[model samples]
Target: MGIILEINGFKYFAPLSSFKPKHKRLCETIDFIKVGIYAVINLNNMFPAPLNLCKAVQIENIKNEHYRNLVRAKYRIIKQKTEQIVNNAKDVYNHKMINDGKSKLSQRCNDFRNLELKCKEYSDKKK
Candidate 1:
C-alpha cells in the first residue's frame, strides 16, 4: 500500500514486505530494494493502482510510536531512492514487453502491459 511509482502513464503501487529470513539470503536486485532490515520493496509485484482506488496512509493515526517511526524511516529511504525505483520499474516493464514475458525476470514480474490495459478500462468506466 506504499510507494506509488508512475511508469508509462500508469501509477504503480509496489508492495513493501517485511524482511523475512529468506530475504537475508537473497541479494537486492534492480526490482528489489532493502530498507534496512525492516522491509523490502518488491517492484516485481507492483500493480497499477489508480488514485481513486488508493488511500493515503495517515502516519499520525498510527498509535504505536515504534510503528510510526519505522514507517517514517522507511519513507525516508524510499524518497532517496525514488529515481532508481522509477528507472528500474521502467526497465522491468520494457524488458517484459520486449521479450514477450519469456525471461526469468519477466516471469517474476506482474503482467504490466495487461494491467495497464485493465487500468485504462477502469478509467473509461469512470468517464
Candidate 2:
C-alpha cells in the first residue's frame, strides 16, 4: 500500500515497498506508526516549496548562461545597423557641404535629414 499527501495542488505518494532500510526495519518492528511517520517526512520533502526552490535555482542558472549572450548579440546587431545609417547620413552631409550651388546643397541636406529621421523612426519602432 501507499500513502498520499496533497500539497499546493500537487499529489505525492510514498509506497510502503519503497521505504529506506531504516524505515523498513522500523516498519517491521513498529509497523504502521513508523511507516506513517516516514511517509509524512517523505511527502513533506516532496512538497511545492523545495520543488519551486529548485526550479528558481535552475532559472537563475539559465539566465546567467544564455540570456547574457543573447542580449549582447541583440545590442551588437542594433549598434552595427545604427552605425551604418549614421555613416550614410554623414556621407550625404559631406556631399551637401562640398556643393557650391544653393539648390543642390538644399536637396542633399533634405536627403540627409530624411535619412536621419527615418533611422530614428526605425530605431524607435524597434524599441
lDDT of candidates 1 onward, in order: 0.85, 0.35
Ten contiguous residues with the weakest lDDT in model 2: 40-49
- Angstrom error of the Cα, residue 16, model 2: value is 70
Pairs that collide, model 2: none
- The residue pairs that clash in candidate 1, if any, are none
Q: Tens-digit lDDT track for model 2 on 4-123? A: 333223332322333355675553211122323222122211211122212211223446756555434433443454444334334434554455246543442333334445545655
Candidate 1 local lDDT, residue 74: 84
**Per-model TM values vs. the true structure:** 0.92, 0.21
Residue 109, model 1: lDDT of 89
TM-score of candidate 2 against the unseen true structure: 0.21
**Model 2, runs deviating above 4 Å:** 1-78, 100-108, 111-127
